[model samples]
Target chain A: MTHELATLEKQVADLRAKLEGIERRVPSNKLSMVVFSGDLDRALAAFIIATGAVAMGMDVVMFFTFWATPILRDPAKKVEDKDFMGKMFGTMLPKGACSVKLSKMNMGGLGTAMMKNLMKQKNVASLDQMIALAGELGVQIYVCELSMELMGFKREEMIQYPAMDFCGVAKFLEEAMDSRIQLFI
Target chain B: MSEAIHADKVMDLKGLPCPMPVVKVSKGIKEVAVGQILEAQTTDPGSLTDFPAWARTSGNEIVETIQENGIIRIFIRRKV
Candidate 1:
């Protein structure tokens, strides 16, 4: 009985040590953001959360889909070679992060300009600045390939930032599975 | 001012809003060596909670926090 008890104690100690090792090795600080809205406010919120998480030494991944894909578009590039419907939609959509329409009270683009000015006056980083900061901080920005296809957006039409990549839903889900913070914005 | 503690590096984030202060602090902290102090000055009201919360999660130490005339100062020590 005494020998059995000693062996059990040893086994428990070994298991505890192993668990501690695993815990130390596993990365517990991760944030995954699913950006599904193209609204200026929502995009700002998403980037804010991502930057905050990255500041806390957490790995951050932003997955852009649907209307949110426009947030990744290059402000300088105009999409010209698409089907009639695609061109119509593209022309109607906001060009990029700097031009994203507000979700409410846009007032034919005036609200967006007003909001941008307010953010600027308040010294808050603009969406473009936030995106740049995200790049600097190694925050991964992934655009959903399916969404891009549906929207008739070519990869060349998007901003060519180092942190930005094109991926499918599976990639987003894979990253999200291990993230401690998952947000849908 | 004479009673103020010394910091290895001082970051001015005045007039910045939520998340910017924290983001800038995080970036600025890297310039400080481990065990060194970083002082961040911000006008944002949110830093009251944001700074402490950030320090707690990022394995850093907040040695002191002071607010006066709507400006907030946080002294943090890098742990890792």
Candidate 2:
């Protein structure tokens, strides 16, 4: 009977600790976004939402993984000593934010060029501008280390961003768990 | 038919497309004080709803949105 009582007390204590953890995890005025696309239009949308969230006084965190990781690579800064597969991947992927194509109707880059022309005429911010603005706005840019390892992307080739970091998914998940809004772009 | 709004700051976002209007307004809202009014003039049709929605989510109050000659003039009071 005493053993059963002790077990019950331990279970109650565990439940109480869980409850306290949940209470401490109350969502803040933050937006956690997973940027899974490297397309020009989608990247624009991600950064657009990110910068907009920042303007609203909410903290924004963008986890760039998979196809999205290449968007952060700087065209001017090239990393040497890559493996054969890494070189092939780097050659195939878009160099930077400006080189990415549209998701649909790219038409051998004509559509993308036309769309960029339209945005320019309309005075809309381009993807590069949005990314730069995000940096200026203090939006956290987190690159997925796993994706980096798979694609052989180096940290030295990343764009000049103030609050950028190369981290694992757990770091992003922790922030996402406490964010008021979570988006997978 | 209505009186002019004496805004604390005015942003000319004319010819900017959808999403940019609100994003511009969001960035530009920093110029106004907590209670002052911010006026944004844009030609984009999306601003009709975007301004009010952005103001709602951003904890700001939308004063009025006036449309004249394809130009949308929105007034929002900064609260955040």
Candidate 3:
């Protein structure tokens, strides 16, 4: 073959490869959440947004950091290996999703109860139902290991969720970098 | 608003609030094949803006939206 033709062929192949790379590239359609609030209203908002994102056919990854990790704890499950601080933290923090207090107008738990009753009457999905829906919709949850260590939360104390794992903030950043939507709640 | 549309599926999401209506609509769109229409009927006031905005981002097409008698009906086509 001619040298000029060979050079032209190489250029064609390079262009084709670049085009293929662009064609097969993944879209920026993923959503990431940095959940830092432990309030019941905030938790409900996080899960609602999560479930809605999944419904929109977007991949959702929630990083449960800081106070948010306690929302996933199981009230009935207890570990015997906890130190004094761990035990104290476990006792003081909200045990589960259901036990979380409202960030506003808690009114000594009466406001929370009234809100729950109103939601039931309005046919709005509760926090528990939203969590189940989030799970069913394939929402991935990452518990911050650092937060868990500081808060004295054990992995075994978390509720039985399908796609939950303990990870660091780096994982949250990695997921967030590729996501189209990122929120802190 | 004056006539009825032919849709492959229909969802009556009447009392559901913000996220549920869109969530159900998103779920409902999956039940039908590509190019087919899915109609969602709701009473939620937010759905007026939600349906259009959701369809835009989700890559679905809203064929039409009808509002009458305190009911908002959104017809969407699954594009992807």
Cα-based TM-score, every candidate? 0.88, 0.86, 0.90
Off by over 4 Å in 3: A9-27, B1-3
Candidate 3 or 1, higher lDDT: 3
Q: What digit string (tens of lDDT, one per residue) describes model 1 on residues B1-80?
A: 53478899999999888888998898899999999999999998889999999999888999999988888889999998
Candidate 3: which docking quality band?
Answer: medium
If the candidates were sorted by their lDDT against the true structure, best first, what order would they fall in?
3, 2, 1
Q: If both were scored by TM-score, which would come out higher, candidate 1 or candidate 3?
A: 3
* DockQ versus reference, model 2: 0.46
lDDT for B32 (candidate 3): 97
Query: Mind giving the per-residue lDDT tens digits that candidate 3 earns over A1-185?
Result: 69999999999999999999886565478999999999999999999889878877799999998988899998899889999999999999999888998999999999999999999999889888888888888999999999999988889999999999999878888898789889999
For model 1, which pairs clash? none
**Residue-level error in angstroms, candidate 1, position B61:** 1.3
Instruction: Candidate 2: list runs displaced more than 4 Å.
Output: A1-22
Chain A TM-score, candidate 3? 0.91
Error of 2 at B34 (Å): 3.2
User: Alpha-carbon error at B22 in model 3, in Å?
Assistant: 1.3
lDDT of each: 0.88, 0.89, 0.90
